[model samples]
Target chain A: MASTHLKRTSLYDVHRAAGARMVEFGGWEMPVQYAGIVEEHHAVRTAAGLFDVSHMGEVEVFGPGALESVQRLITNDAARLIPGQGLYSPVCLPSGGIIDDLTVFRLTGDRFLFVVNASRTERDFQWIAEHTRAATARDRSADLALLALQGPKAQSILERLTRADLTRLASFHFTDGLEVAGLRCLVARTGYTGEDGFEIACAWDAAPALWSALVEAGRPHGLAPAGLGARDTLRLEAGYMLYGNDIDETATPLEAPLGWTVKFDKVAFIGREALLAQKARGVARKLVGFEMQGRAVPRHGYALQAEGRRIGQVTSGTFGPWIRKSIGMGYVERAYAPPGTPLQVEIRGRLEDARVVKLPFYRRS
Target chain B: MYPKDLRYSSEHEWARAEGGRVRVGITRFAADRLTDVVFVELPAVGAKVTYMQPFGVVESVKAVSDLYSPVSGTVVEVNAALADTPEVVNSDPYGKGWMIVVQPDDLRELEQLMPVEKYLGLIGEPAT
Candidate 1:
């Protein structure tokens, strides 16, 4: 409740002037909503939504041994990434517990940019620096600001502002030195909303200008400025995991539905052995998606039960606006993780029936 | 504005006496607090409700809150239009957003509720 000492993003003033309801998130004062969560949610789904994601931490790792160091630190195969490509992977503790999930952008042969969660920024930087032998890691979080233009109409809106051939940018690909609104930016055809969008990374001081430009240009396209509330719903509907919520230190990547990112065939990485052992022995619990059968909305920390006994707890839940149902994700007993498995969630001390379903409650056509 | 003719509860519900029955709905203050009501779940008609007990739930995009009954009674009617349009609670809290019509067990219990002035004072709103 005491957020006086919380840090402010570069777009804090802009958010406040727009009448956003601010909340302290991960030690930063960020807007939770500007209009309303449901309204903004539909905006991103039908048209476009602009998001100020400057709070996400950025780390620059550059040296002759950058590739080797990064490959050793991450579970995924960083060697497969060429310049202008980005890879999403989870950084794991040696015991295979997830430290943090991050996106690695290959800038050059010896330079990589890591976009990490704001809450785990310090820890991620420390862990990466301590593990690497020769790669120099610089925390560039304060130097850069990130904006996500997401939705089905995002490309069309963005194409009007930037001269860069956005049509050529594929998913998980980024191009630097793109002139957007006459300002230098690194535009990536990536987003967490499960839509065709772009995330623009630019200088911290230039954030307000870039945000205003996008807002103005995006107005004719039905673009609304969204906040953290809509972001959570959008990502949850997309079946994307949120750090400190869906996956944390207490849960391993294999248990949290991220085993696909853990490449065992790649060179030795931290937690590779433990992950391999877990894979061989099989996991005791697995994360699965579920939809409520009744009107009850599931929430984090809600108990999951089977028959009359508790199985696990819900890690994340929301009234998915697009799906028009209460959807949630939790690590239930592996036996109950199969699609169509019936489960019960204890909401407000009452058991509500729910069914485990395949992930991505909302899939874009 | 708090309606002068309606009795208010500290829990932010308003009740209006209609002969032997009472009309119940959330107050404007409550509706504003629960912005963008996306869903409402009300007790079925003919169901009994107890005073200060949760009889339904109102869900916004970000949160879910229980709706407490202001008086012990039997639900005679529920707003069916809310099933498809819950935002009515925000737009018209006292009119179309009325949650239920209840036949109070005792009409005298309505006198125990606060008047508009007292209820407004409790919520730090000046009495009009």
Candidate 2:
């Protein structure tokens, strides 16, 4: 029995009307697909795709210490984020284990917003609130709805609906009060698919209107209303880690190969000491991207074997629709983390051949 | 859509009898649930399979599922074409998407499977 109450987005009715296949994901009854997974995945890559990311959580931080609190809470250098800019970071426990991977937007010099994972909303908010002394943290997950319009045609499609000069909105920059489809929304030129796109954040109840407008305006551009299924594959192809899947409480950012997110120079943050120690001693095991040598689909929890021994386990694996290869990511002994290292993933009792490759399996051309 | 001439298993496999050999594949309902099937692993020809047992694997980008056998038999043929172009399973699940042909050990085994009407009922589809 599902004990936890499942949440639904404001676009729930619209998704149902569109004949989306619904599935329970991280305590939310969300649409996993609309047209089809591969179809929607292709649409996002080739043209454009709209996504309902309403289930993702948002934590608002305000007050004089907002910048200080955010800097201390995350592994990345949030102080480097100028107003109207956002940066991805990992919220880590004091033990250096990842609490969540979130994006912090600097709305003002003293105001910040942390966009967190749906499942980690409560944990991240509590962690952030407890650690901050002067800044106030409020969970705004219920107040906001996020939509991501991604792909090559994303800018052109969104341009038709809004008068704003999106071309001037550089990547990782956001305008909090941009009017889109006659509604004031926060539009960010950031995306998870490694493509040029915009993440539109609007009031919770206005998502349906925004969604319908985007769908209508994007009709000529071949925009598909994609769902979680396509979202997963897109992120995977881009080598973006899914919190619970690729990184978790037991894995540190260094082990996750997310050392770039850890800024050791910034006035001592959580997990800074432990990460420094890990760096000095060298990470015992490291995450690496891999491609299957055969057709066997390596999946989560599958073992990574090398030299007749189990080296580590697969964290995430899938047949990437865009890349058209069986690609995956997993932690392996530091020795086997190098690109081109031979490896094997035990799938369904058989040791299938695999080899470590680069992090991203696909890059937008 | 479930065809009337075929028999179906509760696991969503369809078996169409061609004399003693039954052509087997997943139903449209199953294919829809497993959207964008990218890879299919079928049993080799002459491999033995049991009734209601897993005979192969069908993997989509999101998940992997087993293909259940509808009757005890030996694999006579496999849709090797699926290895290169598995999306056909989503487009033509009943025709070019056929997974295997099995020579049943017992001809009467077909009767144990559900009729199209019963299968539609099993999947909560309105039986016409």
Highest-DockQ candidate:
2
Residues A1-365, model 1: lDDT tens digits:
56778989889999999989888899899999898888899999999999999999999889989999999889999999999999999999989999999999999999999999999999999998987788899999999999999998899888888887888899999998899999999999888998889999999999999999999989999999999999999999999999998999878999988988999999899999898999999999999999999656788889999978999999999888888888899999988899999999998778999999998888899
How well is each residue in A232-314 modelled by candidate 2, as lDDT tens digits?
Answer: 99999999999999999899999997899999999789998888998999999999999998777889989999999999999
DockQ of 2: 0.85
Least lDDT summed over 10 consecutive residues: which range in candidate 2 chain B? B32-41
TM-score winner among the candidates?
A: 2
Report lDDT (Cα) of residue A146, candidate 1.
Answer: 97
Can you list the residue pairs that collide in candidate 1? none
Give the DockQ of candidate 1. 0.53
- Model 2 scores what on Cα lDDT? 0.93
Using lDDT, give the best candidate's number: 2
